[model samples]
Target: MRLRALLAERLVSRGLGETRDTRPQASRLPVLVPVGPQEDPVEAEADMRRRLHAVPAGTDLVLRTSGSSTGTGRLVAVSARSLLASARATHARLGAAGRWLLALPAHHVAGLQVLVRSVLAGTAPLVVDTSTGFRVPALADTLHRALRGRDPVYLSLVPTQLVRALQDEEATRALRQVDALLLGGAAASTALLSRARAAGIPVVTTYGASETAGGCVYDGLPLDGVEVALDAEDRVLLRGPVLASGYVGAEPGGGACDVGQDTRYHDVSLAGGTGQGIARQEGGTPLWRPGSRLPVTLRPGFHLLPTALPGELPAKGGTGTVRVLATPDRGRLEEGRLVVLGRADGLINTGGVKVDPGDVEDALTGIEGVAEACVVGVPDQEWGTVVAAAVVLQPGAALDGAAVRRCARELLEGSHAPKCVEVLDSLPLRGPGKVDRRAVQLLLSRS
Candidate 1:
């Protein structure tokens, strides 16, 4: 409620339950409630009015998460305390509380948190017109206005947006002026990170989902009062004040409720892979020996899992860190810090061998002519699922499917190479401009 007062013009509320939504039902948690600039003008204004004025006090907020690797979305009941806690940790970690440029969609956590961070920082975030979707000129203009303010400015962007920002001189110039740029939403490529650093943009890679109230980990370090751990399976686990209260049950005919105890959770872990630094007992308990294990190295093309040592857990309403329930990601421990890998669900099983699509995509994107690439598993009678890819090439560059596959073979395992490749003008995107893997698979199927 205090956050509402801070952001007078920006309304925080649940999605309007529009029929044509792209995210799965369970994954639609209202983390940072967006003002739906993409919606019909009349409808968007009406929804904003309802959230701004009609919602009663003591009314709970119901938000859905973007379904994890399992493809099932969960509805969560998040409190103002948790949302604020998440924002406070981020602001503290960055060591600066200033204006944030809201470039992401309000409907998703990354975008909504920009506004939330602004509220906690007591600063007004300059919002860009994402109604036409994220564009270079729009982002540049917003960044310029945000920088004009007295307070330092920050921006949160998905990897896709950053990629676009790097293409244009004006956008790149404006982006470089921000105090800090929080990059998350999806795993950023090494090349992308290098480019950002080269451009002198202060980029902080973040790791967290809607469940943890945005990103609990900044630059692979857990935010203050936040706890990051690994499960027996090497999956990442998060616990802290930033954690959401837990999920809510679906409505009778299919919808989410604002309040419910039927689905309160303690911890959740995603399926994780093995790592070099991991030492497990016979019965499967991880033993941590930081910096004493294998060189703390990660494979070039393959995704690695991050391991963790146990940390202090806080009591309810107490002034300590929360506990990890579970997460869908995999990562490893580097010295004392947490290192995240790609999601376990992103792994593809072909011919009884596990292959990471992320690795394949990494290989594809690294190719000279490829601007972006998304690799997915398509149903195959022979191999259970065969690797397929959708790629977007840079302007004036010509790349055939054979060249794409050839590039993957050079960087990835033969099995990891795409069995089929589809060249497109652009990759399909979903929530907050993240690549839509499901939609990419659909494109592969159609071809």
Candidate 2:
């Protein structure tokens, strides 16, 4: 109910009371922390209230990313402007802001955005009770009830949800009726996307993170104000109003970004402003053009980590006049559309050679009967780190470890081939259905 009340404030004033005329008299506003579906809601809300002073003023929502993906742990601070910008952009893209069905956890940006859209549209969002877990029948039943009105209803989900939904005829048919079904949080396998489309489900592949206030790009195209660019090393750079204000430290010892301090690891000749499809280098020099590769240089300064990740890439607010996020993910422009490869941090470095697991996974999935694949780097005595894989075969399909290796070698041979492959019934997941690479690495290490 408190979450809904906070969302209601978005209606009375512009951007959660950030407007000049309607500003509240409070010196510091309390940060809104969403409770997980299964968590004790009363305790979670009380905990957030107790530590209200830690969060800086002007922060609207505080969200945390899964520990499995990012190396560190911290809370993402999103301002009202960023959230509204993201929600409006989505409504504009979908052509109408109608009803929305929330299938993801409220703690996640995707699920929060669903409520935002519903609030903006003046309709209470129909939520599928996902506390126990995702069930196709519950999703189908809730979606059925949500579709009674003439207003177009929308659904947001991850790849794993769609995989299970396609198995049931009622779930698949119910999903097909949604105005637009968003698939994100993790890469959708080629086979999964094909099956969803063949089943007549409207699946729009999304690309973004909690740092960007959910997905700024939908189906290979940037949303209204969102811009996409690549730095010299092909690291994805994003800029727009959708970017979060900054991040707050999780606690005293989370090993994440420091709260209210210098977050920059190295000094860069940075110059940028708030806009679309354009980025500024030093001296206000425009350096990036859409659908083209542009290299932004980083001058040597205080280096913390050796990884190509901007050491601790400051958030849109913490940085400076520059508001771009240098995402760990790597991507390339394909015929004017962004094709994201695997994350740069997730790359397997074997024998001093860098290998992208996405390339290997894509190659493996190209083989017949291979449903999905996750490639990781397990510690090897000789190679320092060697490639390994976990695969989920298509239903009723039989495959062995050798066959999976052969398929991987056929396309990405040499150092990219998996040293050992584990054929699991399903890949392990964390958060809203992202592959748990850390778990995969641990499992492959034992084998």
Candidate 3:
């Protein structure tokens, strides 16, 4: 049997049996499932059975999207060919040829890609427990163990994991031990990436999804056979060998090829909030729109665009197409290097203007007594929303809301200035470096 067929067979035998049916199963995998710290193989098996029941027979493709909390939750269908192509493309791009530390959940495409790459490379991946979230201190030990074999060790981490690793001195040191670290899943804050680079961590930003098997674009460049294009709307679209086949629960005639004109192109629009475009054909020609009406463009054969429309209009008023596709949520491609903004979700829309909280945080990084800061939009009747900042002070340092606000005004426009500031010993971080915006909202609500 061909390698693709063998892979399909293996995938079917290993919890993907539901894909073998031609008719869709009654119940499919939940689009989102949150796994706790403990692993229950029996429960997992049962869940897999339930999920498999939803897919059609002879369907080897499976689609999984990201959940609200990060990790694995979304489900999309992908063909074995797409998965293999993605693995091969990643291996070729990274030139990976050794053991890898798998700290992400197996249900996630990123984590699953690591496993698939390991198998393709004829090496077993070193698994780690990410059920309780990323434990950087513990991961340090795992990294050490994975490196003992003298094989070129590689690992993938989200910004949250990178932040935690940076917090631990040992883990920071351990980062240098790997051949490469693919930092992705979401945008890494500028502060976080700066710290990682300063620590001499060989980190590369990656972009892709289950549709592409894994990371199809590394550091703003497409992998071999992966093509990236931007539509008139500035949304990013992708076409390549690594693209997935389709989605599991997608409406009939809803695959990537249904967008407009051709299957070779897809639409990806950032402005639409779908974070992906549509694949359509016009006059037998394929065209991709970056910004689609859907909240997310999932399914195989459709690739997320690499570029987004500029958040703000250019200063000179020169006319250019502004499109938005979802990937690398923070940074953008400026010149050639990826210049990261903070987070799209982190942007504080105040008075009809979007303000990246990181912009404020970055300007205040060197302030006399500020240790860390988070900026958020607070509800205000006067203005649609007012800019609010939460600051963590350094030990033995004195700072006040007025002082911080004044400082912010000096560094930012009046429109971006903070109306209220709160001082704290430390900001609440969700996983590692991620500021819990919801918690921040709650903090202000009580204040």
CA lDDT of every candidate: 0.65, 0.73, 0.60
Tens digits of per-residue lDDT, candidate 2, 155-221, equal 8998878877887899999999998998988888787898899989888899988888898899999
> What lDDT tens digits, residue by residue, belong to model 1 across residues 374-410?
8889888888988999988777777788888877777
Which candidate leads in lDDT? Answer: 2
Question: If scored against the real structure, what TM-score would every candidate get?
Answer: 0.75, 0.81, 0.66
lDDT of 2 at 187: 87
Which window of 10 residues has the lowest lDDT sum in candidate 3?
319-328
For model 3, how does the per-residue alpha-carbon lDDT over 207-236 read when each residue is reduced to its tens digit? 776656777778877788775544332234
Off by over 4 Å in 2: 10-29, 40-56, 250-294, 297-320
User: Which runs in model 3 stand beyond 4 Å of their true positions?
Assistant: 1-63, 69-73, 250-256, 260-348, 357-376, 388-407, 418-447
The local lDDT score (0 to 100) that residue 260 gets in candidate 1 is: 15
The lDDT-based order of candidates, best leading, equals 2, 1, 3
Error of 2 at 76 (Å): 0.8
For candidate 3, give the lDDT of residue 248. 51
